[model samples]
Target chain A: MPGEHPQTLTRSTVAVRSASAPAAPDAETLHEIHRQERASVTGAPVTAPLLPAERALLRSVEHAVLDERRLLTATELSALAALPDSAVMALASLAHQVRLTWCGPAVEVEGILSAKTGGCPEDCHFCSQSSRFDTTVKATPFLDTDEVLEAARQTAALGASEFCIVLAIRGPDERTLARILELVPLVHAETGLNVAVSAGILTKDQARRLAEGGVHRYNHNLETARSFFSEVVTTHSFQERVDTCQLVREEGMELCCGALLGMGESDEQRIELLSELQDLDPTEVPVNFLNPRPGTPLGDRAPVGAWEAVRWIALFRLALPGVILRYAGGREITLRDLQAIGMTAGINALIVGNYLTTLGRSSADDLQMLDDLRMPVAALTVAF
Target chain B: MTQLPAADSAPAFCTGCGQSSASCPGCGRDFDPPRYCSACGRWMGVTVTPSGWTARCKEHGEQHSA
Candidate 1:
């Protein structure tokens, strides 16, 4: 949208067609003229028809991202989502090109250790850890420092570059905050892993302390668009979540954030969520397709289809070209055998080993998948 | 590298005053004492030593001092 546009064809279509025309009309100019003519004749602006192989909108986005390395505007991104199925393959191909250009062929693998499990007070509709839910997850006390260190050591041995300590709570109280400050440095010192945390809604002071303690990144997912947020979680406002992310950034810690897909949100809402995330400009975006754990409110919701998942991943890459796009929870169940296809669709990172409440495929399988794709596993330090 | 005793094997009472229920050094409020906070009412399964303290809370999850 910010690029140069030639203004000749709109004045005279005959002149555009003539051999003696000063210069051949570019595709953009021609399309603009067609749109204007259709508007004048039919009283409505219409997109010029695209050929089966040449999806104009998708091609324009591809050119902007892959060739010019420019970020796509929201309008251009919306047009990409509206592309017909015939253009899906080309969209994926261009997204892959953009991924390679901006992020390169190295895949970053991160492992998550649920340091604290269950007994959460928040009632997020999709989560199994909520005390209100009748799910099978049993509440367990936080692991001991040595146990957490052992887990971090194991995660490092598994070849994951990043290790996250996740807790299930609305927010960390003073004592909990003190404990995190303690564990962070030790994990870094012993395991040499880039430590991250997913403590729920954080205060500014908590964020500052986490930053001071050598926590490399702070993950607090926006979860969904602001409009659809209340439908997902009622106890906290979406602004509260945004505030925590801002606090993390204010403290100079890298923000690893994203949302869960296939939670009955509309495509428009997904676009809105992406637009917000683009504004947030997180260092990493973990896209989790809802696995719909049993006994949760959204348990009966359907999983996102494989092709739909690929499309969303491609769209996310197109929308946030420079950010790290991770294949997070529910990939095993939602993507099924087409997991490799997601890699080609623009995912550059993965949560190796088990997820928070669900079992993921083994780390070896994930490594082998990367090998098969000819993308090397990037070193831990390389990710930052 | 400083070696810490295993968390499960650490003393469950305050190391400073050797009391089960004492005022918190942090907030200065009466609590179940060290290792656990009574004011916050969160389990801070911690152990304090001459070198430093290692604290872990069931609600807060993990924390330590080098």
Candidate 2:
């Protein structure tokens, strides 16, 4: 965390301890410092299609930190993350540094189970589960609570620090919510591992209950940029997702939000997506490349190149500086031979083994990837 | 302006070629192709006018005179 000069450190940090007052941005000089950041983007190397002015504007937003401009124009942000190969790598390296300085070398391992697979009502082109597509994936109802608990125990034995129970529906209904609530305490008592949930769009009351039920973090992916969201999902509005994230936060639980790259979204769209996630100030951001599952609307969509993925990771490090950038889904298929190289590109956390709908690389392979990077996962574990 | 929904209801249309075929016929977009024309090997959405192949890249949507 960048330390503010004592005089500049707003008294609000102390005030938060005494009462709940909004913290000022240190001082107005902080805003001026951010204003100057816009000039740096101009220094980006030349590329076809991208104007130097656009590059500069992107740099301004991509490099924006706490004391600087707090946000970027949607157009500028898209350009920053959408750079071709090497340039993207450079940006990713910077992003990694920012993430490291703020977070640390800690890599959190989590196990994810799609409690209810397939059968989604929303028409999100990226999802194979949506009935709108001919994905042909079977939809199952809620899993038995006992079955879910057993999976949690297995995850704990496998050395996973967290177990994330996910469902494919838009949101959990009363019955499903009740089922999850019933098992939360059992999983905690038996496995002793932190539990998280991605039960879909949540309300304030539901979010509060989940938190009380020992759901440490609530994952609700923004999926893509607001501008591009409608093109990806029609049944749900972008603001609805944002509101759900806000609800999770207001309940005092950690907010986990991330985006899926390579859905034919423009680089500007990717940047805008990250910028929006930054605004919400999530505790963790899982960066995933589009894997293009067959039968889904985006099945034919090409995956983002390995180097491009690396660059996005680096850019994330620079922009957020302090947020957790977990390299989630699509690592094996997207990064290929360069899987280990991702660590140096500024990735700190990783999702080991299997993902929700797809099988991941073997846990041994992941352990080797970490060992090859010579970056030890920090032992100071975080539950949320 | 209203943001377009991320989900495109239209069946997968080859972005490279204007053909509304279900998938790219793997025309010129092979592993390698002519440098002068990015979409030389790929499906082309626009017609080959008197000028040559006139198509827009899926990402930039810029008119490319190949």
Candidate 3:
């Protein structure tokens, strides 16, 4: 088990396993969505029966996503979010159907290596890698070629088709770019894994160079909705991250943009992110719940509950039916034993081994989960 | 990790610095105590919280974060 970086920070089945797996969360496990007043986007009470109006809303959204193969608007997503906790299971079932219809059952497994650990210049408040924080993380230089190759080989052994070289920096400079370009091919040659990079923001030329260097995908998380972004990290604007994502796509590399949830954002704000993602159109959306790193700005915040996490996973899938909805970091502590529920809740791909700074569930356990669910692990090749 | 390190088993290197010395300035950040024993790679039991943290390798006793 990967202990949290102390910074830090699957699936399976084709058919529905349990309709009410997430069931209604009891008071002890009430979702953070209920703790705040934001769920009032709908006039219906939590105890309100699914009025004809609300049912029609869900059915309309379902028809658009499942029948028309279209994306949901922000208002539609809000209706889903405002659903009584009892409707979460039904929402999940609909999301599961959407995943099966749009993305199919083959799960993509990936392994990530923090090639350069810690000492990040930018202060993304949720991260422990920032040098600005008083975190206990030990900073290390880039791993040697041999070490990088070894990690790639380890990734390959885990049946992962994708391997990401993650570096903690604002962006890659000349030396860092050279090292990454050099390593991308060697990793591909050694492991036959699709190479991905998450080196923060990028310039237009840099994005072009990486794409030319056999980098198939680039990861740069939007972290949260633009409305709540400045509340967390002041080092950089959300626009910069979006620009890098746009640059990656413009350079012909697949963009892997994502969001980090549970950072005190509202349900409407989360819907806003989903809505923006509709315009961004990333090939993959890695859903990361906040694990709450100690010594960071978000350290004291409560982690997103497991059931709530599943609800959003389904929502992500429903909102973006075509993208690879990956179960990313912070899941171990966030989901614990209920991890399998996510598989049925519209999660189509996952990071198999360790994460950037956090240890994940054993690769064996994750693979076994796929096997148990009868979902085969397959590599994905999506268009830009 | 799949197995627990035996008591008196060797301490494994830090996942952070890749060294056995947990005292290294670069090692032991957000991790609880230690999931794997320092001298060995056996999975340990670690519980972490706001006030304090503990990692026990079964064989190597226990240590908190530096």
Candidate 1 docking category?
incorrect
Query: Considering DockQ, which of the candidate structures 2 and 3 is the better prediction for this target?
Result: 3
Candidate 2 DockQ, CA atoms: 0.02
Model 2 C-alpha lDDT versus the unseen true structure: 0.65
A56-133 per-residue lDDT for model 1 (tens digits): 455556666766666676666666665544445667778898888888888888888777878899999999789889
The 10-residue segment of model 3 chain A with minimum total lDDT is A7-16
Q: Give the per-residue lDDT digits (tens) of candidate 2, residues B1-66.
A: 122223434323433333444455423232111111232223323322111223333443434332
- What DockQ, between 0 and 1, does each candidate earn? 0.02, 0.02, 0.06
Instruction: DockQ for candidate 1, please give it.
Output: 0.02
Residue A34 in model 2: lDDT = 34
Give me candidate 3's TM-score against the actual structure: 0.78
- The TM-score leader among the candidates is 3
Q: Model 2, A51-138: lDDT tens per residue?
A: 3332333334434542353444444344454444425544655555555555666666676776776778988888767877865344
Give the TM-scores of the predictions, in the order they appear: 0.74, 0.69, 0.78
**Residue A72, candidate 1: how far off, in angstroms?**
1.9
Q: Is the docking of candidate 2 incorrect, acceptable, medium or high quality?
A: incorrect
Residue-by-residue lDDT tens digits, candidate 3, A150-237: 7788788888898889999999999999999999999999989999999998999999999999998999999899999999989999
